[model samples]
Target chain A: LAKTTQPISMDSYEGQEVNITCSHNNIATNDYITWYQQFPSQGPRFIIQGYKTKVTNEVASLFIPADRKSSTLSLPRVSLSDTAVYYCLVGDVSNTGKLIFGQGTTLQVKP
Target chain B: DAGVTQSPTHLIKTRGQHVTLRCSPISGHKSVSWYQQVLGQGPQFIFQYYEKEERGRGNFPDRFSARQFPNYSSELNVNALLLGDSALYLCASSLIRVDNSPLHFGNGTRLTVT
Candidate 1:
């Protein structure tokens, strides 16, 4: 399991693009970086995932450098509903998919 | 398709008592994993079971145990519950073939220990 570090919280205005970066200096070669979002009283929901470079989906985009030591999740056109806790996880899914969640970055989207 | 479902959405127990939480996976998922989420903190992995076998175990104490039935449904048992045991228990299910497929999560069971 690769330990991840992220900002404790971030503030964003509606209609703005918000990018949250995570640092995993000890990422293993087989480890894949994944991001999840969680609202109050609910389980974390999958947002996006990437191994290297950039991967985009309907919801969000993931950017990983060649070193694979760090990654970022980009949310476009934010809204108050987008305000939630975001988690960055680096682990080998082939093993058990047992994710170790850190104190995620709380994104507060304001009007 | 229906997402993962957990029973007893809210539970209250006293110290030194026992409690059980149940989860039903998606229609075709064969893997079920359990996590503990405390207020103001991220979730902690507890156990993972695949094909009725234990696939992974986290750092949780032996007081916490789980099993997956042939149908892929799972049950988590906690004994000697303490106040610290109070937290939201999450159940996630996924197919075991692909390594990168995302796990579908249920709303979660909120257990409060008194």
Candidate 2:
């Protein structure tokens, strides 16, 4: 499991883009970076995932550089409802669900 | 399709007591995993089961055990509960073939140890 470090919290206004970066200096070769979002009193929801370069989905985009030691989750045009905790996880799925979640970055999207 | 579902949305137990939390995986999902989420903290992996077999486990004590049923449902058992055990218990399910697939989670059971 690759221990991930990320900002404790971030603040942004509605309609702004928010990017949360995670650092995994000890990422393994097979490790994949994934992000999740959670609202108060709810379970975390999958946001995006990537191995290297960049990957985008309807919800968010993941950017991983060539080094693969770090990844960034970009939420475009955020809204107040998007305020939630974002978690960055780096692990090998081949290890059979050894997901270790970090403390996560609490994004506060202001109206 | 119905997503993952957990029973007893909320529960209360005293120290040293035992509790069983249940979860029903989504239709066609063959794997179920349990996580413990303390207030103001991220969730910690507890256990993962697939094909009615233990596939993985976290650092939780032996007091915490789980098993997947024949129908792909799961039960998380906690014995000798402690105050620190009070937290939101989340159940996530996914197909075991592709581990990178997103995990579908239930609303979770809020367990309060008094």
Candidate 3:
């Protein structure tokens, strides 16, 4: 499994775009990049997943470089509600499908 | 459709004691995985069960174990718990036991070991 490193915390103002980058230098061949969001006390929610290049959804967008060494989760026009911890995970495909998590990036969107 | 659901919203246990947490996955989900989340940290994978068989286990000790029923409901059991065992136990369900499937998580059972 590839270990991921992200910013410990980040601050942003409302209506601004936020891009959080995650680095996984040793990503495996079958690893897929996925991002999840978690609030104060709820379970982590799936935001986006991409194998390569870019994947855009209604909530966010994920961009992966050709080397797959790093990825960015971009949230457009973020609001206060976007204040939460965002996790970037390298997909585990060893038949276990067990998820590995890192400290994650705490994004605080303020007004 | 309902998302994953876990029972015993909150629990408090003593050292050397044991605890069991239950989870009901979405109506048609067939794979269930368990995770432990400490305060201010991300969720750590514990175990994964699919079609009533154990598929994966994490770096946790022998005290941590889990199983999935034929119907896809799952149970996480911790024996001889320690203070460090106090954390949120989460259950995630996915439609299949494949790597590409995104996991749907439950609110989780909060366990406090005193």
- Selected candidate, larger lDDT, 1 vs 3: 1
lDDT of 3 by residue, B1-114 (tens): 889999999999999999999999999888899999999999999998989999888999999988888888999999999999999999998877455878889999999999
Residue runs of model 3 more than 4 Å from their true location after superposition = B97-99
Off by over 4 Å in 1: none
Which residue pairs does candidate 3 place in steric collision?
none
Tell me which residue pairs clash in candidate 2: none
Instruction: Order candidates by TM-score, high to low.
Output: 1, 2, 3
List, for all models, the DockQ compared with the true complex.
Answer: 0.77, 0.63, 0.67
List the pairs of residues colliding in candidate 1. Answer: none
lDDT tens string, model 3, A1-111?
Answer: 899999999999999999999999999988888899999779999999999999999999999999999999999999999999999999764457687899999999889
Ranking by lDDT: 1, 3, 2
For model 1, report DockQ: 0.77
**Model 3 chain A lowest lDDT segment of ten:** A91-100
Candidate 1 per-residue lDDT, tens place, A1-111, comes to 899999999999999999999999999988899999999999899999889999999989999999999999999999999999999999976579598899999999999
| lDDT by residue for model 2 (A1-98), tens | 89999999999999999999999999998788989899988989888888999999998999999999899999999999999999999887545765
State the lDDT of candidate 2 residue by residue for B1-114, as single tens digits: 888889999999999999999999999988899999999999899999999998999999999999988999999999999999999999998887785776778989999999
- Runs in model 2 with CA error above 4 Å? none
